[model samples]
Target: MTELMRTTSATLSRLWTGSARHLTDDELTAVATGETVAQRTLAHLDQCQRCASSLVHAADAIDLLQEEASASFDKAYTTERHQAQRRRIGRRLATLVGTESPGKVIHFPFSGRPLPQLSARSGHWIAVASAASLVIGVSAGQLLHFHAAPAKPISSDGVAVTESAQTVPLTFDMTGTVKLPLLGDGLQHPAGEWSSLTLEEFDELMGNPAFFGNDDLALTNFLMSEFGSIDALTPHVSDLPVNIQ
Candidate 1:
């Protein structure tokens, strides 16, 4: 009977020693929270200072971790979301407005109408030229009508002087008659040997030769002129038959 009682006591001690080992973190958390846990585990905590200290340490560590995470999240939110808002917005807007997509062609937004493309210096020169031309035109217009207006006759003082006229007969006298030379034949002759040649003689020299020579059109023309001159020089016979050939 004493041996059997010793065996039963040994079994009970083994069960008591193993009860704490079997307890889970949930049961320990319950104990740490001051809530009820497994009956055996609660009893072990009440007696074993080691298990109770471990449970308190786990709970405190969990609380410390939670507080640290919360603080870190708040710091990050303040820095990123509020403090950098303007800068972030500026950067985003710059990227959106200035950045071009790949393979996109740039368009000239202001090219709907043609703008005068004069350079600054060229525009200045053109303005100067226009002004100078205008001035020159105006000056020329003024100069064209610059003639002085006719002066008004001055008023004369009263005068007693009288003018008289005398009548006289006028006699006219004639000078000797002048005759002009015929056409231009009387002018200075051309250079060379034909200086004294008459009109008819000068004509024969320009004609072709006679006989085995070519027909002389110039000679025929001279002969015709000689006949005409002879006719003109002949004096017509009057009824008195004066023989004035």
Candidate 2:
């Protein structure tokens, strides 16, 4: 016989003797091919009482075991599907109830609405610039107001009055011999040597032009007799003096 025929016969014999552990449906079908080797093996088994009885028993046992396992798996699958359906229905009911209640509506600020108000509002940079401009305008206005106004002039009435010009003279008594400028003469004199001066001489030596009106030399001689030395008559000629020469 061929090797395939030998192998098929050996496998069929093992199944009949119950020595074969198990055979998948494909293996069993392959051994049951409508070939002469499989037909001969079946004919042999039917004639032999022991092998035929064992084959019948094995087939019955395998069918019963497969039927039991299939029923159990179907029951478990049905139970799991029912449980999943119940959970899904419960979640749907919860969602419906929450939507029907008076709950606060939560919307994403940037996603849901058109944001008309925010879009109309000024941006941060624009707001800052506006505030800065307002401050700058106010500061500029204050500076302009301060600078536009004129300053008040000082009054000359107090110093320009002729009556207020009369004043006491200042004299420095030198301890040692010192040469001093003469009152009427155009030269200096020795210290402690008195030289009487008039108001004109006092004004000329003091560099005040308002003293001698027209003839400064004539006024100098007249002022020399009226006043003492140049230093003594200096105080009498001022904007405002309490004492006179």
Q: Please list the C-alpha lDDT of all candidates, in the order they appear.
A: 0.52, 0.52
Looking at model 2, residue 132 earns an lDDT score of: 100
How does candidate 1 fare on TM-score? Answer: 0.25
* Tens-digit lDDT track of model 2 for 1-245: 69999999988987786545443344344444423434545555655566556556667776788899999989878977989999778777877888444445787777775655554345776798999999999999999989994542222421122321333234434332222222333456543344445555544556865543344334333545453334232322223222214
Name the runs in model 1 displaced over 4 angstroms.
1-37, 79-245
Best of the candidates, TM-score: 1
Error at 201, model 1, angstroms: 90
Candidates in order, TM-scores: namely 0.25, 0.21
